[model samples]
Target: MNDRLNLFQAARFGSPFGSPFGSPFGSPFGSPFDLAHQAGEYWLDAWQRSVLFMDAMRQRGDDHEEKLTQAAPHVLNFEFDVVMDGRDLARPVNYSLLRIHTPEGVVVDANRRPFIVFDPRAGHGPGIGGMKHDSEIGVVLRAGHPCYFVGFLPQPVHGQTIEDVCQAEARFIAKVAELHPDADGKPALIGNCQAGWQIMMTSALNPDLTGPLVLAGTPLSYWAGVRGKNPLRYLGGLLGGTWLTAFTGDLGCGIFDGANLVSNFESMNPANTWWKKEYKVYSEIDTEAERYLEFEKWWGNPVLLNAQEMQYIADNLFVGNRLSSGSIHDSAGRRIDLRNVKSPVVVFCSWGDDVTPPQQALGWVLDMYQDDDAMALSGQTIIYALHETIGHLGIFVSATVANKEHEEFTGAMDLIDVLPPGLYEAVFVEKTKDTVNAGLVDGNYVVRFERRFLDDVRALGGNDQEDERRFAAVARLSDVNLGLYRTFASPLVKAAINEQGAEWLRQLHPYRLRYKLFSSKSPLLFGIAGAAERVRAQRAPAKPDNVFTMLQEAWSRQVVGVLDQYRDLRDSAVERYFMNVYGSPVLQALVGLRADDGRVRQLGRDIARETVAASARAKLVEQAGVGGTPEAIIRALLYVLRAPELRAADERGYAMLRELRTHSEEGKVMSLAHFKDVVQQQAQILSWNEEAGFVALPLLLPPSSAEREHALDVVRQVAGAAGELEGEAAERMARIAAMFSAAVKLAG
Candidate 1:
């Protein structure tokens, strides 16, 4: 027994292949016989788990094949009918628009603004937006809004381009609007991940066709990231630009496999991709199989992109980073400016999203506008919501987010629509005992829009001027290398590969091959299915307290720790390498990167528009003493909250305002669009001349003392909805109340 104990300790602590952290076995703590028994049990349980895991993989492969056999395959939890197929359109693409069937108990209001969810075709196929019950589509449907989904087929239409896809999406939006002419507003557009940027481009091209736009986990400013953190941004610099992209397309016979993009994503987190994910399922095979298979159903099934579409994305957006700069032009040379998107745009991003960090997700705002004033001048209401800790996929997939953030956004769509043109951050604060008017708040949190500025966005980590220069150099080099590849290599490569060979290569890709090898198709895995069933019937999982089980878990953790360290070191090295190579003066010169080119590139402001805006501001100042209760109440609220800080506008306040407008004698005639115009006009008046605007506030109020008192009461309720006004806000409120009272008394 003593000898056996010694040997076990030696193997655990002293072996060269022991845990990455030095073992802590200086003395024996358990009976040798008991330890041996537990170890034997653990091994048996592990063997069962391994068989079950193999069975799960086989099932995943079977599902993949089944999905391949279907037309417009998706993982949406609800039933949907195809409304419009892009393949049937004049400019055919592989996308389709589907109207989701409402759940059994839910009733969708056709008169409510419709919602259209556009899923990302990044690497995986579509349906993630509506993959679960508590998802984007689910929330909209539950709220009685008619929901539509835009998804793509696994294969692209031949000779398709990104331009064709955008045009098709615009047509779909128009069709949805036409279908719901009685709807209160245009259909709200929701884009997730890669789809977010795509919809933005489409909206820019056809602004009038879209309504409010919601972008979840989208990366628009691709090059924007903190140094030493986002190594993927350095990929272009490390690879010497997009020549390899062209090479891959040529090898695909003019089609690019999305599996390559999925592989790149998997490579980002080696520990999760290689071990943690599989190990978790293996350990919890009894409970986790369904979820694991469901997720794999989407991740493993990669769609295809036309080579032209891929090249356009790689050149103009990813490496070029020109979308936000308004550098991309249509076939007719029409500039695609984000400012052209007239509807309110809401961006939902997360700090924990390594794939699309807050910097990349929100950096486009900074690129397009120099300041808050510039954004407001464009008459665009842009709202961004930042999550404290959620990954890229969780921004759309996580049920918790769908129920809370999405629910609040949808519930307050009208409030957002009527917001004055400015930069605002959507903050969802949890309600507690301290929350005032908690009953009035929706859900578990108080959803509020806090005004923000360009500087706030800059505070989030992003590329400095030096980083910009390096990225600029990378883009220029990519163009040159792409030209060289097209001239010398593409033709030869294309000639060497045909459709049949390309299909073979795709089937043999490592990501796809693993699934095929584990499935029933592989003779080696033929017996795993039956074996797993037998094991499941007679399962005997080891206790968590078992010594061997504890040791196994420790070892797994150690492995993850080691891989994380490696990833950190690798990312740091890549960042340094990119900076050293691209920052070189010679390389910059070779790539035609000028010294002054480090400045953030944006479209030159339209002189004609600027003149109009200037005249409009002057006109607003002249009409500072505007007419009626709506303008007076709005102007009063604006005056109290005009400081350079975040101002909270809660749903309860908007609800009260909405009720007031509906029942009030004077406000009943004001339409939402007309009310929005009044709000903006009053806001501009205050912005131009604060003192004069404040003095003129009472002049806009009704002469009747009772009417003036009621208007003041409405303003107080709306302003105090967030909380009791404090400090400057409190003083401003007092002054406005006093001014209103004095004006009423003088009129009497």
Candidate 2:
């Protein structure tokens, strides 16, 4: 019995490779009994330590709960007026106008066209877009655009279809347009997250209602991602397709809880959700936790969607990828064609966003257009901007991002308007103290945009025919399963559920249970009131060397790390398992799925034809005479391309230009009219470059070089001015100057 006990002790603490109890002296020659005793002592100490640690955690949890309850009133008191009754809260000020007030006292000028900001109805409530002065509404308002928020009611209107909500949004836009008959531009629409795609559908159906659109962190290309990167895309397959979504909705008796959506988002980053978010709050509980709790109050409070709506989203948008494929249609048989949108689309996405990655955000650009030529042929202008590292919500909600990215975009709205009907990428660059070309007239930051081929966008997200094939199979299976549910189970479920029962079920939901239990009514929580007050009073604040606190922090971090690794492992296993199961020939046969189908084949062909046509059209426009010949247009484009560089080197080029005096004497006069003509000609030749030259020439050229050396000197000084030439405009100006210098030398 003693030997057996010693053996058990040895196994508990020692490495598995060697037995310490056998020899009775550690190893072959050593006293294994001594080692076993030592091991036993270590384990006993560890067990005691673990017990104490757990007790500490229990006490900490109690304290945390107390602190939370104490702070709840201040943290959860959201100040916005929901009824539009014109009542001002101590926090959120209410307004009747279709405009949001900025902290800077800048009233956004509303256009007759009507601006609508559709906030994502995820787990959170309204005001993310206008939470700070540097937010989406703030940027729009600063630009003098009238803004209206498409906020939801605390409780959803009964029998609300997504279609009904869309119709209501359209009506709101129409009313705004009616109000502003004389506004300069049409109402610009901005949608964040889910709202982004909703607006797209709205615009598709009512094509004429919207003008420009900004879709921030919205995933249109749901199936897009690189390997190991977008694990969320693989989730539906692992969970036996979207049947779970349908099942949940059915169980809710026609209303699906939005908490599931929020929970899914949290699950993607266990580290952030489980530990980092709370730890950051605990570490700075005095101040930072207030904002954290405020956000959580909304995040934890989820809205409900009709089962039909949830099922529709799951089947069509998430799993099917039907929106981008043009496979989705309304009841009226009108295909939801994104290409029908006449206005420009600005897509803003980021690398750090796991929810709506750059691939999902921008991949649809590729999905919609075959090439840049097709984009121009369709008279569509798509501009996309990529951030290095901002999360999904941060793309629209973060104030710093809003001030920089959103502000720059809003400031350059007009530039985007006149950007010619083509695909382009907008890049925001910080200007140094030394950049000398002509276009940049602002601060340290300048937005530099370049015309990009659709192929470039496609390259960002690689083609995965295999994945698409798998998704198609999932779609087919979903349709089959949905049919089975409707034919078999749905009828019984619907007959059994009543309005009261549904409401009861929703109240009893796990997500809502905590909120209901904790709010003022529970008798069990009465003691919590006084306990919270005392805990707040006796709060032992953080210090650098508190060992217990340090251990707590370290343990918290370890827990988070373990959770993260577990999530990653789970994601990988699920993805692999699904790919193996769903990608099988047997499953494909069962579902009557084909890897390559007529729809995909037709889509490919359509893409090819569109690309060819667009290329030809762009080529025609590029070769079109500024006035007469193809060569002249080509020359004009070259001239415009080099204008900015030449302008910058004008001083250096002026020496050569001084040699052109003989030519100027010989009726080769450098007049403002000729310069203007050259710019206009260049603009017309390149089609898109036409505006660049037109805008550039007025700013680039002085009245004349009539005084030769004096004019040249003034031109050089103006050209050398710090803020004068910047961005693409500066580059174009320099190129023009270079071309002129070459032309002059040849003539000489």
Candidate 3:
């Protein structure tokens, strides 16, 4: 065995197998082994390159610090006023009180429309949505809309419950509304990531205040995932449920470090965290590294949450899955039911987001509402968009995503608001320059979207109950464990902690300790400057195509693969162990001891019945002549079937229908009120048919333009053919031609 080991070692980096010089484990100044010499040389060269890279980074940091100090004089820094006096920094942005004061500000002189843009409070500091020229706030302001930001402080507010934070957001919205008495629409709410669900909860609780809501990269259904994939969903069960979170928060005397969350995110992609990101910086050290480091600085800085808040999130959201299940209730006995939210909900998720898998991000809709009928019964319009390959942060942070997904979404916000209360999928179809007509309102863009059915969303990721059931089991176990922990362990832990102990614990936190201790202020870093200069002067970077460099890259990849495999093994073992332990029938029986006293079940049944009744009433209204006439309906249906070549034509038709309906419902005096009402009612009825030309055109157009034109010609031919029939069918053909003429004029 010793001989074999010796031979292996020698083959790897000794004598003729190693490089002539600079080999990782070869003779100091002599030629290494010939056969595998390049491998040793590569390892040595990579090490040299890494040392030089570190030196470069230190120098760059020094330069950036100097530049930041110089630019401080020119930069305009804004201050925020904190509502709750806490250790954390919670500063609100100072914007014009009147909507008319800002370019994007819109105050419907008739009714104030309050708009809140809740930026994600992840590891990064606030202001991404409102920081730049072309941002969420900018977009809203450009449209003459009122905007408010929910910004948090650098530190967390002591004892701040997530509920308290939510309440504060609600108060802000209410205040904005009060300031503008005559706004036309309810306040439009936009939430990104962490803030997405936060706003959702606020909206669900105070449904009356919210209008259209956009939830980007927000994971409402946390436990929803596909097998083997979305390994992050299995983390809670793997880590012994929320016990570790409780322990950490206890150690900090109630503050749970946000750094831990950031760390978990980083761990998801070892390649990015350990190699790709840093290597990209080193490879493009002159410029790319600066931006990489700037982002890393924010990515590294994590915030804190109160123990109670973290505990609630873990039990109710992550593990318990109670939010979607309609089992969660606020302190005041108000059930935090997602189904109660009346406004249109826009869900933006991506397939590549491991942190918030597509399932976790959208599965809540399936969980809360069994089908489109249930969603319609609740008077909710839920539209979701699925991106093929953007990561969690990229969904909100990436410039490309901002330009495409966000831009298109903002433009279509009004269209989304008018969609009939039902479940629909927003599909973004790529369009070519040649396909775009010059007369269109939107500029030449490569993509356009159309609303689709829930089946399209289901097709993207199969909506199966079996995987969700496993998560449901996790949720059940979490409740029992949390109850036991609170009753038996929380008191003991709390008693052991004090202010000083909490401070010490925070200082000792793995994330905080690294930044606090290793910074330039640290005494040990006194010699870092001199050492960095020496390293910079002796820098030797590896050549991209060198045999030695290639070998080094291969070894690095192997190491990464091994690490990933080990992590997978560890995660698998942990999940299996916990699931087995917690999923035991004995434990389940103990947990089920406090099962609902039947009142909750009865109440749900009552609510469901009321919802069904209301839905039926709405359907009746739709069916009656009160909304529109039978002749008008036939006309609209024919127009929809015949006109298949228009751009954004379906949405435009829907918009026109919505406007007409709104005017008619308001009883507003207009010269063409009756005509508009008749046309809109017909449009609404036609919109219901999934097989309508407008509905199918977006999906069918790609086959071939000739085929599409042929389809359109066929519709016209059918109309002409219908003219040949006598009596009712002949009258229908005449109405169809009239409707087509009116629609074409409106579209034109």
Candidate 4:
């Protein structure tokens, strides 16, 4: 054995072998001895990484166990006191409303609008919204807003339903409003992922309860997605529409294990879930363990839901796609129309979010209104912002986003609340050295509201008529399958299992078993902690230039590439299969659907209401030449900045406007609501007839030369706060100035 080892080592290092083969290659790469030494170091480092990786797994399992022991098991990093418990409400649920204790050195304004963050209850436990210092709750608090959190327990209340939860949320909002009676506006509601639709429904039913609403990575139009890009939408049809969900719920004996949903999410990205995630931690075990373990504390602890809640979500929202279509109703049987939401809605979604793509986030606007005119006439202010590339969770939890997107959204809440009722795209651009009025800008970025049309939304991509028909067929078939199962299979399945048996099944689930198997209490991880400690004391991480480390990373990339390809192929095949099965005329006919008519469930137009709105707009247009300085200045500004492309604004300009409001005679007497009304009225007048609106602009201005000059100066200050007007904006501004000058000469 010694002689063989010697021979092998010598041949590899060119000691015993002839010099030509090893000597020639070794010059460009490295000396054989140098390579051998580096290889030995890599092996040692790999050994250390293995021990450290096992230790991280053990610590993660330990953390999961610790979380399970807590009564609420929330991941919120901030300390909070429970203001109201859902169990004490008329409609009991597992959720609770918490008032986040203001962090030291952070001063909160009592008169500012209070912020309530509603975290999603889809599969995972609550508190991802505030799990880190740079999170949704953190941003709200730092912005001097009174912050509140709506979180839930790991276990659901025994008889809780989705309706009960929605009711509970409404009550919570009312309580927040009542608590802050001196606040300038109603409480701003921030919803993440699943909570987005939930809050939207509650707001629709009780339209007056909320202020501006921020929905981050929310999916309202569940059935809307591109053809091959979204395969998760095809799952309902492939599984034959909600039957498996029903079966799984039945197997849980009235309780549904959220692990099932978590598993599905993991399946979406097998490369990340199974290999790359853990491998990255292993490769950088010295530094990555803490982050991996912290995230696992939330990701590993899947929360429970009552079977009824899951069924409603699957049947009504996921497969049925009823919410966006206005088919969902309250207990009073009133249709839950999205138009009923009185507050301005700011939707923040990402293009790279496969889970809740921009299509799903913004498609609801297309579903609710037929055109830009319909939306404007409905008196709903909708603003949507798109990120170039961010994943679903990153939309709310990422530190980078919290600093940029969430920060701007919250900072501009007051501005959004007073926006005229219409569709606008929120655009954010970086502040540069040459940016006009640089001192007026607040931060590294400037945010502006750009007017948009329905076509702008359609450009994001959505389903065709055939796709809608196919999804509708799936919805119809889902109802039939759910009914059949409830009648035939549910009773038998429920009878076979009780609560204790269900608990056993849940504990034995593959997702849960992995955590338990690697826990500190498990026999398998007996010596891992001590071994890891020893390795840590003698730690030696490999350098990036190490040959073995490079090979390891290369192998990992190849693995990920292969898995990604498999996912694409699988998704493509699944999409095609679904289209074929659900699009068949025979299947569609059986499911009581028709290809000739592509209209799925949608709210019919209320001609009477629209007629009343049109009349109101006409009356406003007839009086377009009315109002004094405020109306004229605002109208002139809107006219000059009327191009379809995005424009920029700063908070300082809004602040200046507010100061103007406080100092002026008309501003001191007018209320915020009245100001919004005036802005909207003037905007309508301009839309009706731009040329006539411009012709009547001087009529709206005061006859006194000084007053007219003051109003024009304010417009120039506010408009120029962004920068010197350019191109058409500059020409328009010049025209307005010329109009004012001519009006002044006549007055003289």
TM-score of each: 0.94, 0.72, 0.73, 0.94
Off by over 4 Å in 1: 1-29, 596-600, 643-646, 663-669
Candidate 4: tens digits of C-alpha lDDT, residues 38-148:
788899999999988988999888988898899989789999999999999887899999999999999999878999999999998889999998999999999999999
**Which regions of candidate 4 fall more than 4 Å away from where they truly are?**
1-29, 622-626, 643-652, 663-671, 695-699, 745-748
Question: Model 3: C-alpha RMSD to truth?
Answer: 9.4
Measured with C-alpha atoms, the lDDT of residue 647 in candidate 4 is 41
In model 1, what lDDT does residue 348 have?
96
Q: Please give the TM-score that candidate 4 achieves against the real structure.
A: 0.94
Alpha-carbon lDDT of model 4: 0.85
User: How much lDDT does candidate 2 score?
Assistant: 0.61
Of 1 and 2, the candidate ahead on TM-score is: 1
Residue 85 in model 1: lDDT: 90
lDDT of 1 by residue, 296-383 (tens): 8888899999888898999998899999888999998988889889889999999889899988898889888887777876788999
Residue 469's lDDT within candidate 2 is: 68
Decreasing lDDT order of the candidates: 1, 4, 2, 3
Candidate 4 positional error at 19, Å? 11
What ranking emerges by TM-score with the best candidate at the front? 1, 4, 3, 2
Q: What is each predicted model's overall lDDT from 0 to 1?
A: 0.86, 0.61, 0.58, 0.85
Lowest lDDT 10-residue stretch of candidate 3 = 71-80
Higher-ranked by TM-score: 2 or 4: 4
lDDT of 2 by residue, 219-297 (tens): 9988788778898888777766677787777777777888788878988998887678756655555556446644554
